[model samples]
Target: MDIFSNLWLGASTAFMPMNLFYGFIGCLLGTAIGVLPGLGPTATIAMLLPITFGLPPESALIMLAGIFYGAQYGGSTTAILINLPGESSSVVTAIDGYQMARNGRAGAALATAALGSFFAGTVATILLAVAAPPLAAVALNFGPAEYFSLMVLGLVASVALASGSLLKAFAMIVFGLILGTVGTDVESGTPRYVFDIPELYDGLNFVAVSMGIFGICEILRNLEGEHERSVGVKRVTGLMLTRQDIKRIIAPVLRGTALGSFLGILPGGGAMLASFASYAMEKRISPNRAEFGKGAIEGVAAPESANNAGAQTSFIPMLTLGIPGNPVMALMVGAMIIQGITPGPNVISDEPALFWGMIVSMWSGNLMLVILNLPLIGLWVKMLTVPYHLLFPAIIGFCCIGAYSINNSVFDVFVMAGFSVIGFALSKMRFEPAPLLLGFILGPMLEENLRRAMLISQGDPSIFVRSPLSLSLLIFAVVVLALVLSPSISRKREEAFTE
Candidate 1:
């Protein structure tokens, strides 16, 4: 009852004319970018975060989250029509979807993807509303030691995110923690690594680092060569799925939705896992599993459903626990921090409108995407034709403007440029920069909580293990480490991400 009441309050805010407008724009932008091959939500969100600086936090988050899931909706179109996956989760969809297109069923493939995603997204929204409150309640009971241990668990889980070496990811996180320590010490008020520069006292600018790693470096990567791809849009006979097609997809859709909703709440690659796992499971259960790599609709239905559900539910940790599950959520965390709001268990009580409105907007945005994407599919396809050389310049301009506007300081611009090179170097070394952003974002909190735990225990080292909850979290972290290092899961994990 209370959840419903809170949702009602959220709907009132999210459905306000201006908030609805932001949600629509975000969905439109997300779909446009998703239709563009070689682009993803992380880069788009990082680039557009500056635009949301002046908006209300509720509207801003609504837009960002909308963009995130909207990409899923549009990714299928490209995957089906062009044999190219615009979103990571759309990879499996391409295996069957593009074949269907080649076989003159592009409409069927696209329609199945849209409908399946809608159904799964709706189910996952309800699940999120139901699951989030209990999770938040549990998080509220966590002591400083518990929080510290939880963060350690999060960092450890992120190490599993690396498609390559675990050691490299671990090194990147430690490097990020070092970057996080640049600001003044919260406890002593003494600067830790400021290099006597006043600008460094407040810590490295997150936007700068994020933009460098995700935005500017991406632009530089794009400029490296003149490779090009074209989107081919097939004329569709109808948008309607036949009765037999619906009957065939119903079971796979349900199963994928269930799988995705469960996996989506976990930290580290939940959406990606959901999509890949759904495809693998459907292949195992389908009567025509031999037809998988061809034009099997089950392949399209299952992974699309799972990916949408997963994207919708991935908001749990960031909203409830203050830990980002993926890079997109990390950008969301940075946006919230920039807006002078802290994310975590208290966000629901402290900023209920922002918390619940974002949830309601997700549902709204999903509906909007369904209506907008179907009729405007042509426009999204046309979007893929724009030249990258032109796009990168505009992105660079926006990045500079965004970084400079944060403090109206040129110093931030220089920092961003410097980090751009670092980001480029890290990319060359095959290091994943996302975990570092998580570390940088969580670093100060990690230190603060560790100190608080120590002070509360009168400097006893055993305080972390003394509390049952903290100890449990540490044990979970170890389990996560074991899972990461296990030869079997490691091979599967690599195979899953090979797309």
Candidate 2:
């Protein structure tokens, strides 16, 4: 009964005139960014963070969250049409989606991606509404020691799950941590690595680094090829799905939603991992595994659905526990903090409207994405035809705008360009970017909590082991590290790392 009442309240908040408009705008913007290569939800939201200063916290969050999942819907369009993934999560979609486009089944693939995402997103939102409160309650019991250990476990899990050489991932993580330390020291109030630049006082902006690495680097890479201007010529027609398509997709969608929901709860398990994992699982379990990588409808459905589910449920940790599961979620936490809304267990009880409003907005945003993406499929496909030369310049222009918008500082633009060079070098060296992102996002929190724990324990390091929960978490981290470094895993890791 309480849940029903909360749902009603949430719906009412979501349906309000102003909030509805914001949700629509967010969905539209998210789709646009998603269709365009380089500009992802993370960079987009960070760019818009300043603009949300005047809006209500709930409305701001609704729009930001919309952009996050709406990208999932729009990303598949590019993946299917051009074999280019607009978002990292959509990379797996390209495997089957592009194959379908090549096979003259672009329409079916688009329809499946859109419908599967909508179904999964809707189900995941409901699950989030039901599951978040209990999880938040459990989180309230955690102390500084537990938090520190949990972060250790998260970092270990991220490294384990990443698709590359463990050593490379570890190196990238260490690099990110070092980058994260460029600003003033939080505890000592002393400068560390600023090198005397006025802008360096605040540290390396997340927006600048992310935009440079993702947006600018993508443009530079795309410009190196002559065929960049040639757009995909695949034709799409019809919206109706065949009965066989429906039969093949239903089971995959269900399985994908389950997998995505679970993974989404883990730190670093963002939409990209969910989508790729879903595709891999579907291929491994399906009797027609031979059809995978060859335009299988199940391949499109499972990953598309899982990506959306993961996008939605990833909010669980951010909203309920104040622990961001990914960089984008960390930005959302920053937004919440800016609004004076501390995200934690009390958020649900003390601010039900905010919590429920955000939940309802997710459903609204998902619906908007479906409605917007279906008819616009042809238009998005047409965009793929834009010459790479012209498109790359436009992407570069937007990257500059996105970087400057974060803090309205030109310094960020330079930072982005710097990171672009670094990212390109790293790519050349075969280092995975995702693990680095995870490290950049977690490093500060890890250090902050570690310091706090030590302070509380009067410099006694044994405090970590004194708490059974923390001790167990540390043990788990060590085990995961061992497994990732094992010889059996090293061979497989080499193959993934080669890309």
Best by lDDT: 1
> Candidate 2 residues 1-499, lDDT tens each?
8889999999999999999998988888888778875567876776676677779988898888888898898888888888888888998888899899888888899999999999999999999999998988877888889988987787777777767667897898888878888888899988988889989988888767776676676666665664553446456787779998999899999999999888887777878778877887898898768999898999999999999999889999888877776778877877886689876677898889989999989998888888898887777766656555666676677668767776788988899889989988998899866566667766777788889999999999999999998999899999878876888876654543332
lDDT per residue as tens, model 1, 111-211:
88988988998898888888888889999999899999998988888677546788888888888888988988989999987888889999999888888
Whole-model lDDT for model 2 versus the true structure? 0.82
Candidate 1 versus the native: TM-score?
0.97
User: Among these predicted structures, which one has the highest TM-score?
Assistant: 1
Return the TM-score for each candidate structure: 0.97, 0.89
- The TM-score of predicted model 2 comes to 0.89
Looking at model 2, residue 236 earns an lDDT score of: 76
The Cα error of candidate 2 at residue 3, in Å, is 2.4
Colliding residue pairs in candidate 1: none
C-alpha local distance difference test of each model: 0.86, 0.82
